[model samples]
Target: MSADLLLSKLEGVRRTGPGRWVARCSAHPDKNPSLNVREVEDGRVLVKCFAECDVESILSAVGLGWDAIMPPRAIDHHVKRERRPFNAHDVLVALETELTIASLAMLDIGKGKMPSDAERERLLLASRRIRSAIELAVDND
Candidate 1:
């Protein structure tokens, strides 16, 4: 699989600040963030579960099969490996990421404004910009 494709799929799950990701573990009842998926060397994915889950199990949880993503020689090795399918839940995650970024931008705009009507108008405009970015992503999909 292309790294770009995988990166796109991981858009929302990738956190922006200190922690690099926010993923729900498929191996456990993850009501909150329990997994961190990161891009390592040679486009390999590095995953760690906060709940003390194993790597293979975490791979299986994301709905990804090794054959399609791993090298041919490694296919048999990862035959039993699996990941959660990219579904509505994944989409929601991406959308949430986009929204979070947008929200930050909105906050920045708000902070920049003084005690004036123009500041409010600029904040609204900045928020619209964020909304537009999200709409574009959905439309393209």
Candidate 2:
């Protein structure tokens, strides 16, 4: 569902800013508007209740399921494209690329060849990136 349709279904919706609106919270007895509703650039509706109401409860009160807040393309099969999930193989490929570049640079260094300033900077960046990737992989596990 579009943000306009959702806002229309809500009670006491008034524009607070461009693409932003305030509405009465349906999850509880609210005299003043407590719900902040906005449409992001990607066409997804964002709803937040200032009363600290849970999203599920707020959506239930307004008779909308989770799908209502998702991007339209995500709901339409014709528009939705399959996305690959990031896995160990993807991480390994990135690490391999970094390692290959570092290894070649090291080989040149071993042959008594001095690296240019740009090459040295690239080597440092590759090292830092590999360390970061390792940390990410460990944290993921």
Candidate 2 has its poorest 10 consecutive residues by lDDT at: 77-86
Q: Which candidate achieves the best lDDT against the true structure?
A: 2
Question: What is the alpha-carbon lDDT of model 2 when measured against the actual structure?
Answer: 0.83
RMSD values, in order shown: 21.0, 10.0
- Over 82-139, each residue of candidate 1 has an lDDT whose tens digit, in order, gives 4434366665775676567557666776898443466566556656765775665565
Reference-based lDDT, residue 45, model 2: 86
Model 2, C-alpha of 22: deviation from truth (Å): 0.2
Residue 136's lDDT within candidate 1 is: 57
Error of 1 at 24 (Å): 1.3
lDDT of 2 by residue, 1-141 (tens): 457867877899999999999999879898999999988877778899999998789888878887878865756754444443458788789888888988988899999998889989988998899889877666655
On the 0 to 100 scale, the lDDT of residue 45 in model 1 is: 53
lDDT of each: 0.58, 0.83
The C-alpha TM-scores of every prediction are: 0.37, 0.51
Which residue runs does candidate 2 get wrong by more than 4 Å?
72-141
Worst 10 residues of 1 by lDDT: 2-11
